[model samples]
Target: MSSLQSVTDDTFDEVVLKSDLPVLVDFWADWCGPCKMLAPVLEQLAAEQEGKLTIVKLNADENQEIARRYDVMGLPTLNLYKNGEVVKQLVGAKPKRLIEKEIAEYL
Candidate 1:
């Protein structure tokens, strides 16, 4: 199983923009409470989706350049990308099913 991967400004292109499967990127920062809440949900999804999807984490604080490029307005913004372009964006903490539903179109 490909565990959830991390994307940095330097590696975003290779990991996310070029991924074969739809990529779910969780943009978070260390000090954000909602980001903390969403982290475990992402972890569970990472394991559940093992081969069906790709999950990546990007630290908003550390990867400000990438975050700016994507226009992340807030912490814990979940962006769904397919073929190098963003298809959907979800903000704040949400249930796993809701997140799964948001990406259903991509699947």
Candidate 2:
């Protein structure tokens, strides 16, 4: 099935903002092509970085509030949260190496 965990506006704070491990929240929508393309990359990251990081997916269409609060202006935005604040923000579908490089410091 799905490798990535799904989070909503209600669980956003507890599951992501308050998480002990760094959280990567993917802000996306079903209709977005780039979002779909990035899903597999996210799944790979979640599998490879298990204990080091927590990966959560938020459907922008379903959780507009959280998306808006985080200033998610585009599809497939990946926001890394640490200590209840955003530490890194990556947008669009990128290669795994590039994505990892961007988040390397956080990990």
Candidate 3:
């Protein structure tokens, strides 16, 4: 089982936006290659960061409304939500180290 939680448009607000911990929302699609590449890295981070951060996956294809609301134009786009707002955005498949470094401050 993966540590990452799956969030749909219906649960998105309560799960990610209203989360107590910082939320890393991964916007991805089934056919996105880079999204597949980044999944394991995110899973690892979700496990390692446990209490410090909350990581969730949102299918951009299935939940196009939320994706468009957030202006996600690419696959594997990581949007860090803090206090119901996006604080940082990473728009590609990146190494775990790079991902960590990018969102370190927010974590």
Scored by lDDT, the top model is: 3
lDDT of each: 0.89, 0.92, 0.93
Arranged by TM-score with the best first, the candidates are: 2, 3, 1
Best by TM-score: 2
Q: Which stretches of candidate 3 lie over 4 Å from their true place?
A: 1-3
Please provide, for model 3 over 1-100, each residue's C-alpha lDDT reduced to its tens digit, 9 standing for 90 to 100: 3457899989999999889999999999889999999999999999899999999999999999899999999898999999999999999999999999
Looking at model 1, the pairs that clash are: none
Give per-residue CA lDDT, model 2, range 33-101, as digits (tens). 998888888899989999999999999999999998988999889999999999999999989999999
lDDT by residue (20-59, candidate 1, tens digit) is 9989999988899898888888989888887788889998
- On the 0 to 100 scale, the lDDT of residue 71 in model 2 is 89
Runs in model 1 lying further than 4 Å from the true structure: 1-3
TM-score of model number 1: 0.93
If both were scored by lDDT, which would come out higher, candidate 1 or candidate 2?
2
Better model by lDDT: candidate 1 vs candidate 3:
3
Candidate 2 TM-score, C-alpha based = 0.97
Poorest stretch of ten by lDDT in candidate 1? 1-10
- TM-score each candidate: 0.93, 0.97, 0.96
